[model samples]
Target: MPRIKDLRAYLDALAELGDVRTVDRLVDPHLEVGAIIRRSYETCAPAPLFTNIKGTAPGYRLLGAPGALSSAPGKPLARIALSLGLSADSTAREIIDALAAARTREQIQPVLVDTAPCKQNILLGDEATLDRFPTPLLHEGDGGAYVNTWGTIVARTPDGSFTNWSIARIMMIDGKHMTGLVLHPQHIAQVWQQWADLGEPMPFALVQGGEPALPFISGMPLPNGVEEGGYLGALLGEPLELVQCETVDLQVPASAEIVIEGHLSVERSGVEGPMGEFSGYQPHETSMQPVYTIEAITHRDDPIWPTVVEGEPVDEFHTATGLTLAAEALTQLRAAGLPITTAWEPFEGASHVLVVSVAADWRTALPGVSTGELTQRVNDVIVALRFENLVPRIFVLDDDVDASNVGELMWALATRVHPTGRRIVRTGVILPLLACYTPEQRHTATGDKVTYDALLPAAGKGREPRSSFRFLFPAEVQQQVLENWPN
Candidate 1:
């Protein structure tokens, strides 16, 4: 298998699998391009290649729904899988398992090279312009044009002991200025605050389009102090390559399609968002966030910029981050010694829910614990998990439930989960975008989290197994009927 090194190769891989659709007809970058990507995601249509974007330089192009789910019947996650260098038909479980295993290997530091394609054309200081590349107005309700939905921001500690690569939304504030959030407790913000305390602007670079792994590992919720470069190397079974930035002290992927190097002003702020968030809401959120002043721009000849339509589930946001979230959560649960067979974050949940399976025959969290105790232990750990902040509703299912199947998940929710007996409620930091929170609750930054236990109670008295049409007949009888049925 060829290792994914850049955006063009990944696009070629998508084309090879018959999952890419190109549009040579000019499309406006404002709402027209965003609507097409949105429709493509809602329908599980092919990834789009907008060859001609209106009001931009000829060489600029856009890759819509870059790693969104494929509509291919047997390979819905084909784009995501292929991006990770896995088989086109790889399952969510397989992808998660691979990521979990990769975390255990030794970190492979990225190699620094002197020259890179990203620097083929460099614009310094005043010459560098953010709008020159055509920032897309992703939604009509968006506060401004979004140019960083899928890009990775490079930031590290002042001493450079802990470097972080992360993905965050950025809104264009003219040619030299851009604004984006650094949510409290997130690594990027934590590091930026350190620089703020010292009264020094933090050097930074925004990278768009390099190893599909760039964004994948960037989004993984790994342990604090752990950099993504090593984990990404382990995931790809090779060292990541890097190149020094022209204007910033940090380095970016040598193969990146475009690099925007700048300094995040410590004393500056700008009104950043109100974008259609991943939680499917366009909240009335606009804040004075950190201002990134552009100092240099570099890119390969005719580069492709990637963007995601993030509002709803089954979109690029869900497809790229869903499986990774499940993988990280599953790893945490197993390490904590929970009896979780597997976990799945159904794309329909967006970033709000996680479904985990436990075997029907399994019982007890401790040697002599009661079923209630077992459930409590499981609930306690998940409710307090770091990622649980993003997940407010967790469904603990029996092994028979196909967590990946939306139909099965819905059936499990309907028949087993109840409003009272099986549900436990707790409060956590509820993101403002979740619809469950009223505007008041959203403003308060807290909301209720419900843990729904849909598993069979122990394996004893009054045990009622789930009812499914497939289980209506014995295995042998069903096989005979299928073999002898009239054509």
Candidate 2:
């Protein structure tokens, strides 16, 4: 299937697949829309399209759960798969493998255009107010109505050598002002610091409803200094159409539903967050972050704002990030000459645990290898690659066990991983959002990185797995039973 070029095209495809639900009735952006979207994620329902959002002008709409899992029978990853230009029924492993393969291809730069649909309606200076859009209060205890939950924030280094398209939650402080998370070492924060050092506000463009793959790549953990647009192009097998931002020097996806060109203040005066994050918990504390001043706003005739209520399991962050992180880890591990078969971050783990599938004959390749030695080897590679922090916990399972499936992963951990020496703990930089960390650990950004040797004993010793129907029954008998079963 051809890649979905724009948001509308993707939505139309979703409609055909019965994965999009259009809500025409009036819906409040405060909490009602968020509630529906959250419910959709929990129930694996179709993506919600709120056409009659309250307080927004005519033709303005809001799309919730844009990257959330689908409810289509046996096709939970359909939405994510479609976003990546794959078939609706593509499996998790296929999607991850595709993403990993794309990384090896040459970077396809974006094609700059003279004009785009986002320029159909332009508001400048005083008219460029965020209030014109129905930004939603996604969660009850959220600090404010977030305007850039699923949107990509476009920022470029002053030297123009690199451009970063990242997804950072931006909260609407007022009509013309917003605040967002810009943490250390992040591409955005790195560029922002350079601009701050030069005593100038960092130029930015918030792109909403761009090409279907925009958000997935934006949220991906690509290498430092890599332009997301080029990676997106490589993923799509063609260049992404782009248009220069009106106020900022950056270029945005030409067909974006909404583009807010602004200057991110160097001063960290604005308090941002306490919003519900992907960790499935809402931290009560807020932080001082950089402020964004909206200088210009552009959108399509009838724009659709894509919002991701970032909390709990199986949301956009879980589905998209899980696949992206897995692809990254897999690519890096394989490139380092590791005998890794596949890697996956199950949605049930909320991006906390990385399930790494090693080759079944790893012991044969390295005679009489101990679990601790293999665990150390993997840990060294992860630390050397600077991914130890991102992957807090890792479960090493044999390739025969499907790590993508939550049930299979749980079973492997429960049965294969012994309680004593199987668990390897190492101190390292840790993600603060993980619930396992305390306030002090989060404050210092230090914690234990755990790796569990969930692989079964060597040569299948001390284990019996001839229990399931597929394993117990002969192939002929199984085929006959399946053929005779009523549909």
Candidate 3:
């Protein structure tokens, strides 16, 4: 399959592949839409296209979980692979390897364009009303209807040297107002802080749908000073075509379905929160957050709105957020000259846990490794990275275990890990987003991150070869079962 330019093309491809289904019946944007998408995520079912949204206007539709796991046995993560312009049958390991390789490619900058599809239908100032769209109240417990679940927020430093692209949860405040709650750790918040220091509001543009890679790279934690558009351009093997925003100096994808230009006010603050996060928990309280007032709203003739369902494994959070981050981490570790051969976060872990595999012959990577000092060295390198903030635990595995396979990881965890000496605990600033932490730990923003050694000592009496189903059954016998078992 060719690279998907935007969300609409991906959805159309899903329909043709029988990977998506439409709900002809009316569905409420409140709890109903949430319920359906949640179930779809759990079952790895087809993507749900809600045609009869309760408050949808003509030419507007709601697409739930655009790249959620596919139910197809042959290619469960097929949708996620396609989102990054890979083959439908691409495995998780292949995707990670591809991303790691792309890190070495020269980033191609975006091409400047004028009058994009996103500007086909435009509303400025008072006309930039958000009430007309069917912004879904994803969760019943959510404080308000969220319109920016899967969009990209573009922000630039006050000096104009750095541009950050990220995904932050947003709540609809009114016709032309919205509030976003971003942690100070985010690059966007850092840019906002820089603007606040200058006593000026930050110019911003929110893109609802653009290239399929937009959300992927948005969730990706690229290095500081690097442009996301350029990185994405390299990944796609083509330059991203960008058009200047009407109200903001920054640019948005020309193929974007909806673009909202705004000024993120630093002085003004509003209450925002209690939405379900990828950690599978809701915030207990709401807090005063900066408000982003819309200056202009632009979109195509007929636009499809994309949204993600948080609070579970195998959703957009796990597949897109988890997969992309792991890929970037792999690249980072390699660049740092770590012995890591493969890295992945299992969907079963809700994207919080990381499994890193290195060469089984430890001496090959690190000299004088008998005392386990190299383990701590590699662990330190990973925990110190600014972009690898989501990881709470890193499981160091031997090359024998396939880090990409959840089943293989489970087996290694059960057999290789020890409760005492093999574990290395390092203290660090923990993000409050990690649901595993207690409220006290979250308040302190610090915790002991763990690294478990899942590799056997290279030369030891305890070290022994393992057996499995593949080894027990010869290829001839396996082929006979495949040839005759059905009959």
Candidate 4:
């Protein structure tokens, strides 16, 4: 099948799979939209397409829980799989493997186009106002209506050596201004620092409702200096078409539904956050973040805005970021010469825990390496890659257990991991978003990460046969049972 070209195409595909709910009745953008999206994620329901949002112009629609987990039977990851151009029934392992495999392919640079659907209607200077669209207040205690939750914020270095497309929460300060949580170490902030050093405002293009894969790739933790557009092209097996922004020099997806052009202030000037984060926490404290001054706005006819309610598990942050992080981990571990077959970040873990599956033949490949030695090597590799912060807890299991399946991972942890000497804690940098950290640790960004070696005993010395249906039953009996399952 041809890859989905835009958000509309993705919605159509989702509708066909019974994964989209069109909310035609009037809905409030304040907390109603957020509550609905949150409910959808919690219940694994369909994506909500709000067609009649209160206080917004007619046809100015919003898509909530765009990348949230789907309720489709046997395809909980359907939304994520569909975003990657995979079948709705694709497994979690398939999605991760595809993302990781794309990293090995030749990067296909994006092709520039003169015009785009995003430029269908253009508003310049004071004419460009945020009130034209429905900016949803995604949480009850959110600072304001967030306008860029699921959008791609395009930024570049002052010298133009690196162009980064990332997703950061941007709240609407007014009709012409916004602010967000852009912090150090993130590529957006890194680029902003370069612009600050040059004494210039950082130009940004916030593109919303682009091709389905745009947000997925934008939210990824790709290596520094790697442009997301090219990586996206590589992932889709075709060059993504781009169009230059009206006010900024940055280029955006040609098929984008809406594009907001602006410049980030050289200095912090606005209070932002106190919004619910991916870790399902809503700290009452807010911080001063850089202000974004809007210069131009462009959108397709009856444009659709996409927003992700970030709190709790199984949301876009968990689905998209979790998969991408696992893919990155798999790639990094394999490149480091570890006998890793696959890796996964379960949604239940909320992108904090990484479960890595060791190759079944690791013992043969490593001669007589002890389990502890293997665990230490894996931990060292993770620390070396500086992924300790992103992955706070890690579980290492053998290939017999599918790491992507949370149930299997838990089973491995319960049955294989020793009561003592299996869990190792190492000091590392930690993000404050994690709820596990204490106030002091959150303030200092320093903490200990735990790694659990859940691998089975070496050479099957003390390993017992798994009593699961897949392993316990004879092949013929299993097939017969499956054939007669409906009976």
TM-score, each model?
A: 0.95, 0.97, 0.95, 0.97
- Cα lDDT tens digits for candidate 2, 249-316: 88999979999998999899999988888889999888899999999999999899999998889898
Which scores greater on TM-score, model 2 or model 3?
Answer: 2
Against the hidden true structure, what lDDT does model 1 obtain?
0.83
lDDT of each: 0.83, 0.87, 0.82, 0.87
In model 3, state the lDDT of residue 125: 77
User: Candidate 1 versus the native: TM-score?
Assistant: 0.95
**lDDT score, candidate 1, position 339:** 75
CA lDDT, candidate 4, residue 345: 87
True lDDT of residue 457, candidate 4 = 78
lDDT of 3 by residue, 185-272 (tens): 7788889999988999999999988787788889887777777888888888999888988878998888899998988987648789
Name model 3 segments beyond 4 Å from true.
459-461, 471-487
In candidate 2, position 329 carries an lDDT of: 85
Worst 10 residues of 4 by lDDT: 382-391
Better of 1 and 2 by TM-score: 2
Model 2, residue pairs in steric clash: none
